[model samples]
Target: MSVDVITNTSPVIWLGRVLSGLAIAFLLLDAVMKLVPIQPVIDTMQALGFNSTTTLARGLGILLLGCTVLYAIPKTALVGALLLTGYLGGAIAIQLRAGNPLFSHILFGGYIGIFLWAGLLMRNNQARALLFP
Candidate 1:
């Protein structure tokens, strides 16, 4: 296969496969978060001026987890990739805002590099027509 096909497609599929466990774990955390009394988390959210930051966080986590699950389906690879990419973007942005260098690099820089590089190869000629043409 050409680099395009591999990068744009395979990596997304691979990520879905690899993150299956992580997705599940995040979902579990989301559920547990809903059930348990999370005073500290709520307090942090309140302090941050994000009225429902905890719920939003849990919702985003679940959304990404669902996207990961959808990614496992071959036909949905592109959609899954978009979702995961967006999720990582948000994660990167949030980490940066918090001045967390370690996680910022790990979550944003590293994942962005890998995902973007891989996605490049997956784009079809039609998708590339505007730029590459």
Candidate 2:
């Protein structure tokens, strides 16, 4: 494995970096909102058929934050991606059950997940090789 491969500073990698930062910021904000359990968060959870208890919300927040943190780390991004995939799957399911819009709501997680993986693939040689080669 050449250092050049891993140390790429191409436009694609830069784009990936930007996308990853955006995704991480989005996930972090979501986790914080869950932990905070503001009225909108509680209402959304309730609408999603979930218990609006602070305990549950906080626990989910911790889990999401942990996964997002892992994803943000270059060394653990793969594991974090896998964990977040499952989390996004759950979100998709909830939105589906709630009869939300197909593209905007039901497939929103998939959209984010694509960006997450795309960023990883572009920014990480190991990820690109594993996924593409």
RMSD of each: 6.0, 3.1
lDDT of each: 0.52, 0.89
Span of ten consecutive residues with least summed lDDT in model 2 = 1-10
Per-residue lDDT over 28-132 for candidate 1, one digit per residue giving the tens place of the 0 to 100 score? 464466445277656644544557555665665567557656544456655665666676676566556655667535365455435443443243333334344
TM-score of each: 0.49, 0.91
Error of 2 at 48 (Å): 0.9
Instruction: Assess the local accuracy of residue 83 in candidate 1 as a C-alpha lDDT between 0 and 100.
Output: 68
In terms of TM-score, the best-performing candidate is: 2
- Tens-place lDDT per residue, model 2, 44-125, is 8998998789888999999999999999999999999999999999999999999999999999999889889878877888
Model 2: which residue pairs collide? none
